[model samples]
Target: MGGPAPPAGPGTAGLRAVRGKSIAVLGGGSLGLYLAGRLALAGHRVTVALRPGTPAPSGIVAEGDEQWSAAVEYADIGRLRGPYAQVIVAVKSHDLPPLLPALAALGDGATEYVFLQNGIPWWWRGIAGDGLPRARQVVGVVVQHSAERTAPGRIRVRRTAGDRYLCGRPDGSVDAALESLAADWRHAGIPAETTPALRRQVWTKLMGNATLNPLSAITGATVGELATEPATRAVLLAGMAEIARLAERDGAGVDNTPEQRVARSAEVGGVRTSMLQDRLAGRPLETEALLAAPIAIAEEYGEAVPVLRTLYGCLAFSSTSPERNPT
Candidate 1:
């Protein structure tokens, strides 16, 4: 029911067409705050549900290519109660478990649960399979915004241009609410849209992530370094080729070639990947979803992803072993 518009597209043409809707963002990370701030500016009543003990800022401030600030209500995720128009689950896959009950509870009244995770959702089989009612809708977002938290309640959007937020339901069904949100996001200066080819979008994003993220974390390289350095770049291209093959076999082929994906990523310049940031900060890496799950899928299809496997082993070992602990 929707697609991408040309650059310089839909500049607030229908900004006031849709009324403000209630939205609950379940994370206070860079992406979550950026979205919350933008949504509030779009006139939505946005509440960012932060993790317990995390300070709630009086307002959110965004910097870099895009700049703005907005006020949003905050709540401890554990104690969050809601009947918002939609609930955006913006946390990583590893942090999703404890939030399941909140989701199940919110499912009863919220129009949809929008998952913003990177790798395959555990609920891919069916959101309802997790005991969510069939009547409840679930959406997936493929985020292209390269951002990081610069300070409490502040987000630094790293990429200078071409930030797109692609959303779609798992069943590829048309979602009017999402379409409306997309339009408003565009008007608010964030490139966003909904697409029927969501699975393709997921695979396409995964192709880049699987290739760049692990390499970045392992070598402490930024996106540009991984793309330009011959040794790292070779491994990156090899891994991307493997994932592309796997995606094709699964019937959700990536849209671009490995080289094209890498070239596009090079545009991001020296921005550190989320994985690399997590590694440096001593936070748990999302290896299971980003690497293990894909590796498992490859194994099931009798596909070999030796480069990914090697990267995964190194990352997994470091994440768990004492060698990674700061003295």
Candidate 2:
């Protein structure tokens, strides 16, 4: 959406997001903590919602010296109210039932939404099926370099590339407001940008997630372990090919080659896939979003995703009995 506009200046985005832009984060997971901490650190009035029956967050400050004790309040997403200028969704895909109605309750005709989730956006096509109010729905890709969840409310983000994110409309509505907000995200220690295209960005990241995340989870192996093993490397390459074909079908151009795609993952070292951590903790894997969705897409295109299909099926069964998986 490159349009004619004045070049970005110091005060251009300064007035947009810095003042009175209240943000509500949905889930109380590590992602919710990370975003809330940064936003709170940036002086935005922020609130993080925790689901019922979940323990209250214990710490006053995040793992880093980032202090969010004062501005960051805890609320329930399903019953949140307006006065919030924007809503940042950092919940698991399956955990939306409680929040949809609450967000609808806000009744603010112009509340911006930023969805922070992994894997494909195919589910959104279904959620937005009936033309759900399209006022402002921005897609984002976050390259979070740090990962640590020591306890329920405790998290450690060792490094962040500023706001290290990208945001824009999926249907090509490029304007100054979104760009200004993106700039604010950058200033909040979370490098961000506004892009005209989101479909490509989503899948490009999914290439590493679909392969690295699951394999690492199953093997209890780090990215380095998975990338180096001959058999694991072969599996990762095959998965990448399928993801590339799927992206092409959906009109997202990305390097789908095994060698190139594998490198993207090999760089992550011994990081534990979120799913692996969930399995170890006896929490439900985000199986439907991360694994099932891609397999469904492969079937839609009559494409064979043998490795992915098998991996998904195995994980599917294992979800019923978390301890059943040998790893």
Candidate 3:
């Protein structure tokens, strides 16, 4: 309805100044805007980085399950300068490569880098090379916020789940920056929390992505549709089972069973997966990170993922089909 109140001496109205930190959210998409707005509401000095040629809005607007607006600083990622206390990398997994140079230039070794991308991170298990600045503290966040960006600085959240954000370190250790950020989000009325089992959460979220993302892109179906339709639901369950086995073998056991995961997907209603959105917009699908990477890992460990392989093949074929409609 209304925007956040003015900061009281560079921090939350009644809180100490030190509670607020300088934060940069690097991405202009739904999750990025939502994080920027909510963090600003929590009295942090928030800046949002937009792509070149994208207009920077004066502030962020969030509607639907959460309703609030907050003024935030904006800059082009290419030109963004940072001595920021924390930098939240909210870009999609496929979009990270070109941004690496810019991200590597941000801040110093003490700056905390919180990566909030979907699927597994490149740095996990050295599955991919790391080009991030050396000595910088990096952490992962598994987000459960269901949101869509309607415009450059506007978002609509369809929060149907209990957890909104779960932040943690990869080594099952606690870090003050992540804990404080999660607390700030909670103070802003977001359901944020910290976890020691971040990798397990990563795999838990991956179970859904590995199953629903590619299927949604290929079938042009919503999350609920894929979870409820008999034909797609069977494939979804089988894929989840495969991912679960893979995760277990990799030492990051997922907490939910296939049935439970499907029930959660059904609860998200009609929201489309990000991969489906990318396909509809004729952008390259995140098949490499979300699907193919996991498949590769499964192969190395001798895990069977036939269902996931089939889904990946269908999605790859559909995304590149000469006759497929872009929209």
TM-score, per-candidate, Cα-based: 0.91, 0.84, 0.89
User: C-alpha displacement of 297 in model 1, angstroms?
Assistant: 0.5
Best by lDDT: 3
Any runs in candidate 3 off by more than 4 Å, and if so which? 1-19, 127-131, 134-136
Choose the strongest candidate by TM-score: 1
**Per-residue accuracy of model 2 over 35-60 as CA lDDT, tens digit each:** 67666666787777777656566543
Off by over 4 Å in 2: 1-18, 58-60, 64-71, 126-135, 138-144, 160-163, 325-327
What order do candidates take by lDDT, descending?
3, 1, 2
- Residue 137's lDDT within candidate 2 is 51
lDDT of each: 0.77, 0.66, 0.78
> Residue by residue across 1-327, what tens digits does model 3's lDDT show?
112323212223443234778888998888888878877886889889877788778798888776778899998777778788788898888888787666657777777888888887866763234556442267778887688887768988775535457777767777676676666666655566778888899899999998898888887899999999999999999999998998899888998999999998888889988887777777777888888889999889988889988988888788778367434
Superior candidate under lDDT, 1 versus 2: 1
Q: After superposition on all CA atoms, what RMSD does each candidate show versus the true structure?
A: 2.9, 4.8, 5.0
Task: Report the candidate with higher TM-score, 2 versus 3.
Answer: 3
